[model samples]
Target: MHIFYTPDITQGTYTLSEEESKHCVRVLRLGVGAVVNLVDGKGGFYTAEITSDNPKKVGLLITDVKLEFHKRNHHLHIAVAPTKNIDRIEWFLEKATELGIDEITPIITDRSERKVVKDDRLNKVITSAVKQSIKAYHPKLNEAISYHAFMNLAFEGDKLIAHCIDGDEKSYITDLVQPQQKYLILIGPEGDFTPDEVNLALNKGFKPLTLGDNRLRTETAALAVCFEINYLNR
Candidate 1:
C-alpha cells in the first residue's frame, strides 16, 4: 500500500497538498476511487480512497483509521552531538526514525565540531524515513542545545550517557537498561565528551553505559543503543 503523509487531513473529506497531489495523480497515476493510505505523523494510520484525481489537489474520502499503529512498549529518545560531517548526522536521523524512536536532540558540546544544525532539513529526512518505513508516528526533532543546557530538561525513566572514557563509570547498554522502559541516551561527538561533561552527567544521575567492546561513531553508537532498547523490549 502506498502511504502519504497527510497531516492536515480531517475526518470525512481530505485534500492532498499540491506536492502529494501531483505525485498521486500525475506520477503514480492513481485515479478516482482508488484505495490509498495516509499517515498523520501523530500515531494515526488512515486508509483513504481517491475521490477526485485532480493533478494539483487529489481529494480523498477516509475509509478507515487506526490509532497508535505499531505502538512500542517504550519511548526512546537519543540526544547526540552533531558530527562535523553534517551528512553523517543526517544519515543517523533517517535510520533512527525508520527504526522507531520518540525524539532526537542535537547536543552542543565543548568538543563538538558542528554546533549549528538546520532542523528543517533534518526533519524532512525524518519525514521521508517515516513514510518509507510506513510508520505512523513521526519522531520529534528537537532543536540543538548545549550539553550543559540539555541536562536541564525534565525527563522521566532511564537517563543514560554512552561514553568511551575509562574507569568504573560505564556499563554496556544491555546491562544498564531494563526492558520496556522510557529512556534517553546521550552520545557525544567524534572527540568524545569532555571529562567535565561526563562528570556533570554522572552527577545529575545519568547512568554511564557503553555500546560494546569496539568504539563506534556518535551516530553508530546512538543507533546501537536505540536498537538494543527496542530489541530488548521485544
Candidate 2:
C-alpha cells in the first residue's frame, strides 16, 4: 500500500501537501479513483480514493479510517548523549523506531563530543522509519538538553542509567526492567558519564544498570535497551 503523511484531515476529504501531491500524481502516477493510504503520525490511519489528480494539491475522498492503539502498554523513552559520529545516532533512531520506542532525547553530558543536532534532519529519519515499518505512531524527538537539566524533569516511570563503571551492586538491564511499565533509560557519551553525573542520577532514584560484559558504544547501548524491553514484554 502507498502511504502518505498528513497531520490534518477535515470533513470527508483529505488534501495532500504540495510535495506529497507531486509524488502521488507526477511520480507515482496515481490518478483519480486510485486508492492510497495515509497516516497522520498521530495514531490515525486513513484509506482514501483520489478525487482530483492535481499534481500540486491532490484531493482524496476518505473511504476508511482506523485508529491504532499503542502496541505495547508500556512507554519506552531513551535519552542518550549524542555520539561524535552523527550517522551512528541516526541509525539508532531508525532501529529504535522499528523496535517500538515512544520517545528519544539527545542529551549533552560533560564528555559529549557532539552538542547540536539538526532537528529537521533527525525528524525526517524518524518519519521515514515509521513509514518503512508501517507504524501509525511516530516517536517524539526531544531537543538537546544538558544532563543536569534532564534530571530535574519529572519522570513518571522506571528510570535507569546505563553506565560502564564497576561497582558492587551492578545489575543487568534485562533484570532491572519490569514488564508493562513505562521506562526511561539514559546512556552516556563515548567518555561515559562522569563521577558526579553518576552520583546525581543515583540520588535521583535512577538505578545504574549494565548492558552486558562487553562495552558498547552510545548508540549500541541505546538500541540494546530498546530490544531488551521488547523482548521481555513479548
Candidate 3:
C-alpha cells in the first residue's frame, strides 16, 4: 500500500505535497481513481482516492476514516541518551517506532559522548518507519535535554532507569513490569549513567532496571527495553 504521512488531514479532500505528488504520479504512475492510504500520525487512518493526478500537486478525496487505529493498551516513554554515532541512535528511533513506542526523549548525561541531536532528521526517520510499518500513530520525539532537567519532569507511571552498575540492587525489567500500565524507562549513554545519576533517580522513585549479564551498546540497550516492554504488553 502507498501510504503518505498527512498529519494535518481531516474529513475532506486533501492534496499531496510536491515531493509526494511526483512519487505518486510520475514514479508510482498512480492515475485518477487510484486508491491510496493516508495516516495522520494522530490515531487516524484514512483511505483516499486519486482525484487529480497532477505530478506537481496530486489531489485526493478522502473515502474512509478510522480513528484510534491499532491503539495499544499501554503507554511507553523512553528517555535515552543519544549515541556518539548519530546513525546508531537513528537506528534505535526507527526500530523503536516499528516495534511500537509512544514517546522518546534524547537525554544528556555526565558521561554522554554526544549531546546534540538534529530533531528534524530523527523525526524523518521515525516518519519513514511509521509508513513502512503501516502504522497510524506517530511516535513523539522530544528535543535533547539534560538528565537533571528530564528528572524534574513529572511522570505518573512506572519510572525505571537501566544501567550496568549496581546489578545486585537492580531488578530485571520483567520482574517489575506489569501489563496494561504506563511506563517510563531511562537508558544511559555509551559510558552509562554515573553512580550519582543512578542514586538520584532512585531517590526520585525510579527503579533500577537490568537487562542481563551481557553489556549492550547504547542503541542495543535502548532497543532491548523497547522490545521487552512491547512484548510484555502484547
Model 1 misplaced regions, further than 4 Å = none
* lDDT (C-alpha, whole model) for all candidates: 0.90, 0.89, 0.94
Writing each residue's lDDT as its tens digit, candidate 3 over 1-234 gives 999999988788999999899999989999999999999999999999999999999999999999999998999999999999999999999999999999999999999999789999999999999999999999999999999999999998899999888544888888997989999999999888999999999999999888988999989999999999999999
Q: Model 3 clash pairs?
A: none
TM-score, structure 2 vs. true: 0.96
- Which candidate number would show the highest TM-score if scored against the true structure? 3
For residues 125-206, what per-residue lDDT tens digits would candidate 2 score against the true structure?
9988988888788899999999999999999989999998767377886678778999989999999999899999999999
User: Which residue pairs collide, candidate 1?
Assistant: none
TM agreement with the true structure for every prediction: 0.97, 0.96, 0.98
Q: What's the lDDT for candidate 2?
A: 0.89
The better candidate by lDDT, 1 or 3, is 3
CA RMSD of each candidate after superposition: 1.0, 1.3, 0.9
lDDT of 1 by residue, 1-234 (tens): 889998777788899999999999888889998999999998889999999999998989999989989988899999999999999999998888888899999999999999799999998899999999999999999999999988887889999998888894577777877888899999999999988999999899899887778989988988887788878898
What is the Å distance of residue 180 in model 1 from its true position? 1.7
